[model samples]
Every structure is written in C-alpha cells, then in structure tokens.
Target: MLRSFTKYLFAPALALAATATTLVVAAAPADAAVVSVRVKGSLAARTGAANWFGKTRTIKNKQKVTVTCRVSGQYLRGNVRKTAQWDRTLIGDYISHAYVSGNPKLPVCAPPAPAPVAAVPMGPTGTMTNEQFLAAAIGPAQQSQRDTKVPASVTLAQAILESGWGRSSLSANDNNFFGMKCFNNAPGSYAAGCKSYSTQECTAQGACTTTVATFRTYRGSVDSFRDHGANLKSLSRYAAAFNYTNNPNQFIAEVHKGGYATDPQYTTKVVNLMAKYNLYQYDLKV
Candidate 1:
C-alpha cells in the first residue's frame, strides 16, 4: 500500500511538468521575418529613428536593404508613402518607411524612454550699463554671426535698440531682446514658450498702432540672440541679408527692407547704434 501511494504522487508531479512546458511553448511568439525591400529614392539611414539623428549612411535609389523591425518617428512624405514609421536595418540603422518601395509589416521596436529637457544656462542679473550690456552680448553675437552669417554688429545694435539696452520688460522678463513674436504661438526649437505683451507696431508709412502681441520666450539672453539670427536666416524675405554678411550696414538695410520691424527708421536706428558702439569689430570677416 505504501509503494502504491508513492507511485501515484510521482505520476501527478510528472504530468504537471509536462503541462507547464506545453503552456510555455504556446505563449511564445513566432520570430519576426526579415524582409528585403528596395529604396524608392536616395535615402539617408540615420543612427536613430528620427532624421535629427546623425546620418550613418546613404541608401541609393533601388538599393536593397534587409529590415528587421519598424518604429514610429518624424513624419515624412516620400515617393512611395507618407508616414512617420521608420524601419530598422539588420545593421542597426534607421531609414524612413515612407521611402521603402513596398509596405512590409514587421515587429514594432521597443520604445525608448523619454529624453530629459536640456538645462538652460542663467543669464545676467539686474540692470546693466551700456558697456556692461555690450560686454555680455559680444560673445553670443559673434557666435551667432559665425553660425548664421548674420553680422555680429547688426545683432548687437538691434539688441541695444530693440530691448532699450536690456531695460525693456521683454528683455528683463523673457530674455527676448529682439521682440520676436510667436506667430500663432507655433512651436520652435529655440523658444521656451510664448508670452503676451502690449506692443506698438508701426507701418512703413509711419502709421503706429498699439496692440497686444505674443512673443517668444528664451531660457537666457544667449538663446534669445541665437534665435534672432536663426529666425532671420530661416525667412525667405531675409535671404538677401545673408549675402551682405561681411557688410553690417548693407545687411541691416536688407533686414529692414524685409519688414523685420514696422518702424520706418528701424534700419537707421540700428546702423547708428552700430557706428556709435563700433560693434562691427566683433563681426566675423567673411
């Protein structure tokens, strides 16, 4: 009777182990099939899912690539399809699925954790003298000039004029020395956010109007100055100003003509400030 009881206990344990193995096998997913697809056109394979990542390589038109998986990223309208999906090549590079010739279903990539917001450096504190303001602005202006081809002299002079030598509420509060408006409060890479302020706008004909406007906010004065240069460079109207980068006077004139400010004497005011301060010394010689 003792021998019979032992056999029954062992039989149940063996049966349970066999049942658990079958359940584990059934729960496992099938391996994703790798697919070879032709690129519809010249495509850049980036290091990550987004175009903001540095390029790893260029995939030429009709080049075949083996894609192992897909992930969502920056939206793109390509010749084949408009999508935000990006494909992961077997070699670990990412290319937009929009550029791939055919729709290929693949396993979704595991999403990465959200990135941290960059810490913005603090700017100068309290009221500053003209000399102090110039001292603070010179470095950022020259850097902006080198990056955007906008004259440092023009940038410095505009800051002085627009921000009232860093005394304006916009400058002191938001660090927006250039009075840059957030048209529709649209998102921008450089802007921290938007704020509302009462402002005066004038027409070329000297017709002035007072109204409330939305303006871009920055983390500090450096970002404000940098965004000013980038903003000017991005607009088609200011395209002519880039050509005169070596000439601050001509550059400011073109900028004024592009309707940067509604003030009729905007160019003259900036030019006068440039000459008075001799700010041209900071401009990069192109």
Candidate 2:
C-alpha cells in the first residue's frame, strides 16, 4: 500500500515539470522577435521614458518596427507630455519636415493638448490690422492686470526676432520657430551669426546646443503660437513666468528678468508693442 501511494504522487510531479518546460519553449520565439527603435524628438513635456513616443517593441504576432518620440529643448527636456500613439506611417503627421524626412519609416505622433487655459475674457477686441504681420510677430498677453511671469512673452518676442515674423527658412519650411537643434538626432544647419546654447550651459541637454537649435514648422501661425504656449506651460522651471500668467505685459517683463531675452530693451519693446496694439486683449479670451 505504501509503494502504490508513492507512485501516484510521482506521476503528478512529473506531469507538472513537463508542462512547465513546454510553456518556456513556446514563449522563447517571442523574445527573439522583439526589436525596439528609439526616435528622439519632443512630443510633450511629461514624456521622458524610452517607450513613450511609439508603440511597444514587443509587436503583436507579426508587427514591424516600433517608434518612440523624445522631445527636448534648452529649458525644456524629455518626451512630450500626454502624446497619443499612432501607427508608424502616421508618425510624420506631427513632426517638422526636417525631422520627419530624416527617417521615412518613423511615424510622427502628437501629444494631446491640454484643456484651453483661460486668460481673461475680452469682448470683441476687433480684427487684426497691421502690415508685415506685426500683430502676428507680437504675441498675446493676459487680459487683466493681475497675471504674473514674463518667460512666455519674452520667449515669444525672441522667437519673433529670431524667425523674423515667422518667415525664416527654419520657421517657414520646418515649422521650427525656436531654431532649436536636432541635437545628435539629425544633421542640422543654421543661419549665419545664429547662437547655440552649449550642452553644459543649457538646462535641457539631450544633445541640444544653443547654436541654431532645430525648430518645427507648422501648418499655420495658430499651430506655432499654440505650441509655443504649450511648451512654456509644460515646464516647472517657468513657473515664475506663468505666475504672471494673468498679466501679459508683466509676464513679458518677468521673462526678460528671467533671462529669456538677452536684449537690454527687450522688456521695453514687448511692452510698447503690447500697449500700442492692445495685444494684451488676446489674453482676455485665451
């Protein structure tokens, strides 16, 4: 009776071992099939992980390459925050021309924009009417006197100067309004006399240098304006700039002091423009 009991227990144990071995072999093929491709570019502020830009490398059954986005800037770094994933073919839909064409296979993806942040309410400020796209060059400001920070305004002004009313080759062709660099991701160029921030000196140094940083050209001016604002809103370091978020002019002044614009008259120019054209009114409804 004791020998019979021992045989029954041994049979179950052997069967369990065989089952485990079979499962391991079946899963082995998947490990070899998985391959990952890392594509660097800004998709949002919160995205920094290796796999955020594209789909997972462990493709389902028979999928091809997986793409990921890594978007960074001098003051801003990491993958774009809150990006929506897309197939590899649609990847170029979000990236600038210069970056998208670099790899035809890489898909472009865009981050979901946050809910519209209200500035102040303005009642029909009237239509824009300036030659040379002057209003376009000058950005919007807070609608009231209570807002704080200047980084966004200051950065906008600088971008205006750098891109020459959004007409620069980088801006017009690539939608790169900031002149940010492609870092090590691609071979990029610059206009003569353009300055680039050094990796050691810049705050976000994922291959970003001050010298003619890469920029993304957009479908329209609205896209550029929106992206510029989103970029500022994403970072914590620019909190001081956002604190004055209610006051567009104050925000411009704050940004100048924040070291956004190097020009000594940066504040004066932005303030003058704001008051002259009532650009601050845009903030009211924004």
Give the top-scoring candidate (TM-score).
1
Kindly list the per-residue Cα lDDT of model 2 for residues 1-286, writing each as its tens digit.
Answer: 9999866744554453231110000112332322243333222211222233442222222222233433321221112212222223223212211212122232223565899986522211112333444544444322112122333344445455556555666665554455444434442322212333332223322243344343343444444444455545554655576677667677766655665545567678767755665554444433
The reply for model 2, stretches above 4 Å from the true place, is: 1-160, 178-212
Model 2: lDDT to the true structure: 0.40
Give the per-residue lDDT digits (tens) of candidate 1, residues 29-129: 23645777665445678999887899998777666777778888888655445689988889999977755554656789767679997544343322898
lDDT of each candidate versus the true structure: 0.78, 0.40
| TM-scores for every candidate against the unseen true structure | 0.57, 0.36
Q: Which regions of candidate 1 fall more than 4 Å away from where they truly are?
A: 1-126
What TM-score should be assigned to candidate 1? 0.57
